[model samples]
Target: MPTVLDRLNLALHYAMETDERVTMLGEDILDPYGGAFKVTRGLSTKFPKRVLTTPISEAAIVGVANGMALRGLRPVVEIMFGDFVTLIADQLVNHSSKFRWMYNDQVRVPVVVRTPMGGRRGYGPTHSQSLEKLFLGVPGLKVVAPNALGDPAELLAAAIADDDPVLFVEHKLLYARPLLEPGKGDLIDFQVEQTGGAYPAFTLRPADSARLTIACYGYNFELARAAALDLLMEHEIFVEIVLFSQLSPFDLAPLFSSLVRTRKLLTVEEGTLSLGWGAEVAARAVERMDGLRVRRVAALDLPVANAKSLEDAILPSVQDIVNAALSLVS
Candidate 1:
């Protein structure tokens, strides 16, 4: 019985096995070391000719992936950390993202740039930034930040199948979480038991007694859930939590309806408050839903510190979310 991450690896392994065009390129994806997070473990051994290890340069990695995509190869490029992608923004935003429209749909860049993002364990400013907002504004690029552990495999597979560039951001915090294997089998049953409990499936809605709609994604979803529980238990208030798995090509239909129902919206994220994903969500909610009362919960507009205390202060906490929700309700 494979966990969700294990299933994701298995899917990638199987995809590469069947499709010769499916290839991988990253800093240390080859055998022995696997990947920095072992997501690509044993891939190089299985597909020696297709799996490639590149230098530490993200620009080069992205450039090569873009070139391969243009030449009819589906390249899954790993950028060790999300923070490092700033170095390759030129290739990702300018070339890979715009190749289709710039060339009048003459070429399609079917590339999946996977990166581990978010702050945990005091990784510091250099490695803690969540840059999804930077690429969200880029046209011709699809951004996906999967909330549940099991969602990434299907989402990644879909991204790979699509004939467009996709930025698949996987939170480092979710790597070890267990996910049930898809399909009915002895393996699936065993894995389901190993998961300990049912995987949480969340939805957004307007609550009749709700004061605020807490919109979140990735690790923030966990915090938002905890806060919702706290609000129910401690304050007798119900807050609707909306988790945004797909960030780019922003879908506000569900959120807009929720805003109309709740009237108040609070966007939360682990990233900085200024010009972050939460701000964008808040802005859009207000733009689309007239008279919506919107607020945001996010890290301060300052660089994260390597110190645990400072990092904790900057990152949104479950308590902070609860307090904000209560404030809105009261």
Candidate 2:
């Protein structure tokens, strides 16, 4: 299996080849260097007319993509860092995201804003923060993320083709890891099943599982699985892991079923602890389900530090997941 970055690059190639309307615009996305992370390598070379290298302004990049999307072009824009998403919030939240509804469904913004998020490479606070929390509840905006459970390329392809505005999040740390397929690699000991949707959610169940389910997405998912392995091997604590790729239009279907069996949920995320994705999940579960206990593990509310040690402390770790799981079960 190819790495997440490989799959994403392949998705771009496939989308551009099949759909004439598909286009990409961003800074440094051209051939050779390929957009910082190289997710767009060889694309500009293939479709020189459509793949545009924009200026450094993130706001302008998204604004142009929004205009293209409204004009019947499916434009996938890239932000160099996820932290810079703030600069384009107005363009995204007020204009592009609301265009369809505000115009009474006459014009559609089929724009996919792809950016690398999460911290690990010590890129400092400006480039290393996970800011998807800011867009979770935005009307008409779909938030999608990819974990290693399945082919991320498929998810990216789906996002690019969707009619509404989508925020596609690529965790920086997950770029180089191989996609975790069912019955292979990181998921070998577990039974992985993906739900049916444009962005599928994966549920991993061990043959012998405890009454606790750990739910996470993106890069923290890698941490959760590792924590689960150690919890099972060293502490005899088994847990079911549910991975979600879709954040907005929040679908709890994949998780509700697991909660039915386990009746215990531990939501883990790289975002901060206050008013985050995990909070929404926990709130909805308590409202819809009966006799469920939920706990959340996320980064500290403070800013992400550039120092590796402080950064690690601010961000949730494998030990955090392990301890949270034990607390949930015990």
Judge candidate 2 at residue 128 and give its lDDT. 85
Candidate 2 per-residue lDDT over residues 1-330, each given as its tens digit: 799999999999999999999999999999888889999999999999999999899999999999989888999999999999999999989998899998998999999999999997888788888999999989999999988776889999999989999999999999999877678776788988888989999899988956688889999889998999989988898789899999997899889889988999999999889999999999988888888999999999988998999999999999998888888888
lDDT of 2: 0.91
Q: TM-scores, in order shown?
A: 0.89, 0.98
Model 2 clash pairs are: none
Best by TM-score: 2
Q: After superposition, how far is residue 316 of candidate 2 from its true place, in Å?
A: 0.5
Worst lDDT 10-window in candidate 2: 179-188
- Taking all chains together, the TM-score of candidate 2 against the true structure is 0.98
Count clashing residue pairs per candidate: 0, 0
What's the residue-level lDDT of 325 in candidate 1?
Answer: 77
Cand. 1 TM to true fold: 0.89
